[model samples]
Target: MTTMEPQGGFSYSEADFRRVQDIARREAGINLPISKRSLVFSRVSRRIRATGRASFRDYLDYVSGREGQDELKELICVLTTNVTQFFREKSHFEHLEAHVLPQLGEKLRAGGRGRLWSAACSTGQEPWSMAMSVMAELPDALRMDLKILATDINHAVVETGRIGQYPAEEVRSVPQRWQDAYMEPMEMEQVSMAREIRRLVTFRPLNLNREWPFKGQFDVIFCRNVVIYFDDETRNALWKRLADRLVPGGFLYVGHSERVDCIRECHLEAVAPTIYMKKG
Candidate 1:
């Protein structure tokens, strides 16, 4: 048995940090600046302890070696933040209710299917909110050809979204109307999203840097607060892909702090703050 060198039990070196950063960017298009070194160390340290590794160097080698594909994904999941709640950004949902839903409803009523995508939908809140807003506007949305595809790169958070249950405090911010219409009381101060609303959303695991499998385009896409972790080039590429995935006149909502300024080839025109419309 090889005796491991302990630099304060769970030592993290600059080399190990750089290696992790490189793998993360190459695999998931996430750019980790030097300021995030502490955050990365804290998160990856937990995984290192969980995996019973002696040092960060050993753990990094294991994850970077041949059999580390799924482990690499697990590492990404640990580092990726999923801080989200129901209607975290109210104006976007309001926009959905006022503009997007009406257009989708008209299409559905006119015998056409409608689709909404909640890309990087952390823990189901965003998609569920979209579903609730849509149902509130169009009572017959489920009966009509309507679907909400909610996807995230993290498998754990994707499972959380699929379950459609949340802590009561986590859901307290939900609007009363939506709470009454779409939530059922769960034990221990928890709430489960109504079955019908859950049915409206289909949860899937998606990595934004990878090629998307589906052929259909979306009438509305809410990909908020995700691209802030990417470099300029990666962010522009992602915006292009998102623009391509949207219907010609479809709506795109992003994070308040994030901007999509210069993807000229994507033909996205800013219509409002943090909102863009795909141009023909």
Candidate 2:
């Protein structure tokens, strides 16, 4: 068996990662650390080798403009590995059930609307699962009319997410009830999310690294599993930005491996093993 090389001892220099990191920061406000020297090189070194460039610097200059944007998208596609599954973090969903939804339901019932933002939705699963969780706890009236905004940097993935199709493996661990409620079986070893669930989510192209216009505040924002890709400054800045848009007493669900400690305003309350909410 051929083993992959360790993600260090990069062929490229730190300058290479810095250039890519600059692109990410300027575009999505995400920054990569110097420690990921190999990760940076591995993700982009092939581009250098493929183009037959003498150095990473030359290759970077080659990708400086319009064509560069295309290359940039390709880089992010490789570097931003958003590995997620439906109900992957079960406790957060449970906390949403046991605490959040009921109160949010009251707000919605009293002519208030509730909306959710899945900021880094990779392939529609997380946001779709969130919609299912909403439907599971919400009554017919509320569940029938829900709004979720799920955005991603990759336009292709964002478009795919809007279509609400996924391979069967993505939903393997999803509870049978929510799966039945949200997914309609299809041929080709896949399933199409039910129209009701699809209707609730709005998938859009958002460059989180760029200026974000807030149409409204969100009751919950799930930025889960994506922050580990960013540098400390970008992480802290993004956390602050997300906190600003989150409704007080609203929830912020991050990845099992990610933390929000640097941001002083929100206290991490461990309602679930991988789940956290903004302190009230």
Candidate 3:
């Protein structure tokens, strides 16, 4: 890749884009194809301005330098696309209500705990939506040791989820019953998740490409949408980790565009569109 002159006051080149893409792939397991050059330039351009760097090359050098660990995190935050909403994919939630939760409820009644994971929980919507669905079926879920772990690699978004607030428009897709039972009005045209719903979720920062610290197995895991940004190898590795982290007969929910065919070795059987079950 040859170095090209600056275009549109953004000093970028093929080399710079490749460097950024390589870093993103290695550091975050996110694949940045050449088609995303413009997107990368736009997202990374902001960091150049923020860091007062002369160009993308200089910015990349700084971020890859010895003192760039924190800056690298900022870069990852900016690069990740977090497009999420309440009940974004209705089918998964429908399945949760219809089949998964009832099975999980039986386990809970048998003195076993129920654990759900929103693996790519962007700004609280997914996990909160999961909580609402679970509550509708199991009203005493929180009292019965039901736990929801919502995790994301983006620090900013994880913090936003921890606050449990969203614009009113953002929560419109949420069912009326859920809104009535689990939403509290907030200023700025927003609403907050009710304590009962919020209490069930614990938000944390996690990188799916890295080792997971928890040894607990989840009864259902919602890892939707985000994996599309990763390459096949990274995606498959994550699928295995998800399989390992799930309890026997646990459900795995993926994005509409993602498939779990590559994880056959994990013994995860596809039970429905974008839903997989770990075989005992």
Candidate 4:
């Protein structure tokens, strides 16, 4: 195989690219195709510079070693995409507000516990949006047994979620009603989520491809825009695991481009575009 010319002052070979593909698949269950070769070079090259490695081979060797676990994590962090915003894919949240929250609200108001999981919750927006939606219907949700769990594979983004702060512009995508009620202004044109809203969400670092620590079914699970990186087998297996984690009649919202092909096997039924409901 012809070696690709060096870019960013680092040599990247087809063999090096294959190494990255193998590591990404093994470490994160991500599938990297030839189309991602340039992407791999561009992103991983920075890691090379940061870690003072001479070339892609050196960097790959370092990350592949037994003592390279931390660098390996950094590599995964940079390679994985984390683009997200408040109320992204508005339809999902709208459906949550209109259909899901009402039933959960009733249960919570009747002194029952409810849980929502924002798997791959990038930067806390999705779970915070969920908290707001729950508050909209149940104003006293903070006093209820309902809560949202926000998790991400990247520890950095998970910390950002735990902090519950975002730039003012990022919060604009949030509904004005929610903005006013759940957000407070900060210096530097940033906004911090109100304690009430933050209190309703628990942020933790979680790798979806790995074992889940806690054991409980969710009333709603938002694993949106995440599985697109996985190959069919990994994606299908993840869908089944997610389905198993849902309470009967629970809702699962995914990315618009993603579909749950194991609906019958998982006891899930499509209820809307990118939404599935576990059968009762």
TM-score result, candidate 2 = 0.81
Candidate 1 residues 1-280, lDDT tens each?
3322234367667777788889889988888888888788878888888888777888888898888777888999987889988888798988889988888888899999898999999899999988889889999987999999999999999999999999988888887878988999989999999988877999999999999989999999999999998998899989988998999889999999998977467888888899999997
Model 1 TM-score relative to the real fold? 0.95
Summarize candidate 4's per-residue lDDT along 11-89 as a digit string, tens digits.
7788988999999999899888899899989999889889998888888889989888899999998878898888889
From the highest lDDT down, the ranking of the candidates is 4, 3, 1, 2
- How much is the lDDT of residue 280 in candidate 2? 61
Higher-scoring candidate on lDDT, 1 or 2? 1
The digit string of per-residue lDDT tens for model 3 on 1-280 reads: 6655465587677888889989999989998888888888888988888989888878899999989779999999998999999898999999999999998888888888999999999988899999999999998787788899999999899999999988998888887878989999888898999987888999999998998888999999999998899988889889998999998899999999999866579889999999999999
Model 2 bad stretches (over 4 Å):
1-18, 31-59, 141-145, 266-280
Give me the runs in candidate 4 sitting further than 4 Å from their true place.
none
**C-alpha TM-scores of all predictions:** 0.95, 0.81, 0.96, 0.96
Candidate 1 clashes between residue pairs 3 or more apart in a chain or in different chains: none
lDDT of 4 at 228: 96
In order, what lDDT does every prediction score? 0.88, 0.75, 0.90, 0.90
- After the best TM-score superposition of candidate 4, give how far the Cα of residue 114 lies from its true spot, in angstroms: 0.6
| C-alpha positional error of residue 202 in candidate 2 after TM-score superposition, expressed in Å | 0.6
TM-score of decoy 3:
0.96
Better by lDDT, candidate 3 or 2? 3
